[model samples]
Target: MAGAGWAPPRLDEFILTEPLGSGTYATVYKAYRKRDTREVVAIKCVNKRSLNRASVENLLTEIEILKTIRHPNIVELKDFQWDSDHIYLIMEFCAGGDLSRFIRTRRMLPEKVARVFLQQLACALKFLHDRNISHLDLKPQNILLSSPENPQLKLADFGFAQYMSPWDEKHVLRGSPLYMAPEMVCRQHYDSRADLWSVGVILYEALFGKPPFASRSFAELEEKIRSDRAVETDLVVEAVRKDQEGDASAAFSLYRKALEYFVPALHYESDARRKEAIRAKVRQYISRAEELKVLVTSSNKNLLEKGNPARELLKEMAKDKPRLCAALEVASAAIAKEEEGRDDSDALELYQQSLGELLLLLAAEPAGRRRELLHAEIQTLMARAEYLKDQIKMREAQSMGKEALAESVRSGCTLQ
Candidate 1:
């Protein structure tokens, strides 16, 4: 199934086309069902002769695991069949290919885009964690995208996965070398946390365009991982990590450190487009850092719960109105997002959606306690919307004073 001229084994109900990918024992093909709908699928054709004893066991384990579990972010195994010469695994087709190709084509992903993918990956991992499953082989090549446009991440290639709980430690080495956790490589016992280390590597590769220890030889990679020297850190990346983790105090400090680096980088950068992007990101971080400063001084809980009394009263008053209560809940969720400070744009969009529903409901209701509370909630959401708009505007603006100063310097140089 792996070598050239190896035709895909015929399936009774599906027509196999070109090969999508090839591995040691199998080749995946893009196929279509023979039914009127002609639905698309991926068929993994594993040549019987290619399977070693261990690979045979892995295949059986993979089939058992995939058949029993289902999650939104995990690739679905629709069906499995085996003939005398080959085994066929019918899977959901992903049009966007694998994450490795996606990143390779882009060179590197924007932080926002990388964060979105990380979130999806984490979601899938959580599902596995709940079921006491660990995907030991977590790498970009094993991750699939649902489609080319606005693709959804799908975790695939679970041949190395196992029914290991968080506390279950294993000494057997598994997974790709570059993406493997240090414990696994050192021949030490490791549990589900090994998968997390791989996740960190995936995120690092996504943001930086390469893993932390990209090397030409096995010795170089091992030395980098096992050496005493700390890997060079990026201030902005550190700041964002802390911010996402809700460590406002640490994030505030890191953001300030990032600004120290960004200011000099901005001044030194000659590329106008790159400078503008950096300037905008600096402004956004500045806004978030200022917000974090206040959050550090005051309890984030207090800031969030400041309006809880009114919200509680509104919820109680709107007991008779299910639609109104649902809208109020959506508004609450939007507030939570804003407080998290993970993505202001997402928070703003949520606020807009919630406001649209609340405004209509308010107009329908007569003047009363519920109406009064609803009105207050609407005003609060409007203020948040305005604040987010100002943040966006500030991030976009190029300083007039700086531009004028540069113009004067250029004119002086010309005269000289």
Candidate 2:
């Protein structure tokens, strides 16, 4: 039975069990709500008498931001209390501790595990960005793990978070120097992309066991961050150029090189979410390479006559039926175009093969709009195959007529 006449719960209502940590602003404690002893929370108690005007405003900002944001990956703020001397914020207690501690203990996370963290962090960032919130201070220390066994991550510490519109041109520089973006280090205005740059630093550290740039002095670090080149980024750029230039082999090689960088990460990663993200990228690159190989080899008679590697690639890709069907469709179209005004037997064969793969996909596809689309595509391919058959027959007939006429002419002349 709770009523307005019931006195508000005092600071003693939450019995502090242990000291968790202390920061520049406040000390945190592991505590239990007395009414329900099972309910545990981390209470951040700030002494008001010691704070200046600016500090109080920063504290208020953090509270305002936390109160408005509700996300699974963001720490939950449960309750708050203010007395004449101090303010207390009761938040969800994470028993596993901060990510910084986890990383310190693990040394370097496997790429898969890093990817899992990256995905959740990215999702949290997107959620904040969507609402015009920028977490100016995003670092491993600000991320907490809910439990040791399951290890669900939650972003915490919003003291430096702020709301900024795209049109805003001015912003004060704040955040750890190691994770700061180039623009921020330069003391220039930046936007949400700055947060992504911090995320990139975290990702690099997670994968390589160290940040991309390091220096004894902050100035040197800033210089390194600005000038440092990412090998994978360069490879991706080159791959795209080669792809656009119609050099499928070169492009495929570059993409493979780019993918190799992630192999170590994937091999050591233990998290499923991270593993899947890496795997998805792997599939994308492989599928693209297969598609290009088909295009390059389809028109080359020499390549086809020498045991077409394009066909082999398609056979391999067929293991993933959806990807195989897509590759076959592209190959079929390219072959049809190349065979125009020439022998179309190759094109006819490709069409039939594509039809076969499409039928397999159609069979596997469930009853839905997607199945309907597959059925329509299959019908169109069948019609094209039929047309190719008729054209081939007409061409054969024309060849036979020409040979008979030539023989008659020779017989009439009789070696005159």
Tell me, by TM-score, which candidate is best.
1
Output the number of the lDDT-best candidate: 1
Worst 10 residues of 1 by lDDT: 393-402
Q: What is the C-alpha lDDT of each candidate?
A: 0.81, 0.70
Model 1, residue 62: C-alpha shift (Å): 0.5
Off by over 4 Å in 1: 1-6, 232-416
TM-scores vs. true structure, each candidate:
0.57, 0.54
> Candidate 2 regions off by >4 Å?
1-10, 228-259, 262-416
Question: How many Å off is the CA of 99 in candidate 1?
Answer: 0.7
71-165, model 1: which lDDT tens digit per residue? 98999999999999999999999999999999999987887899899999999999999999999999999999999999999999988898997
Give the CA lDDT, 0 to 100, for residue 301 in model 1: 47
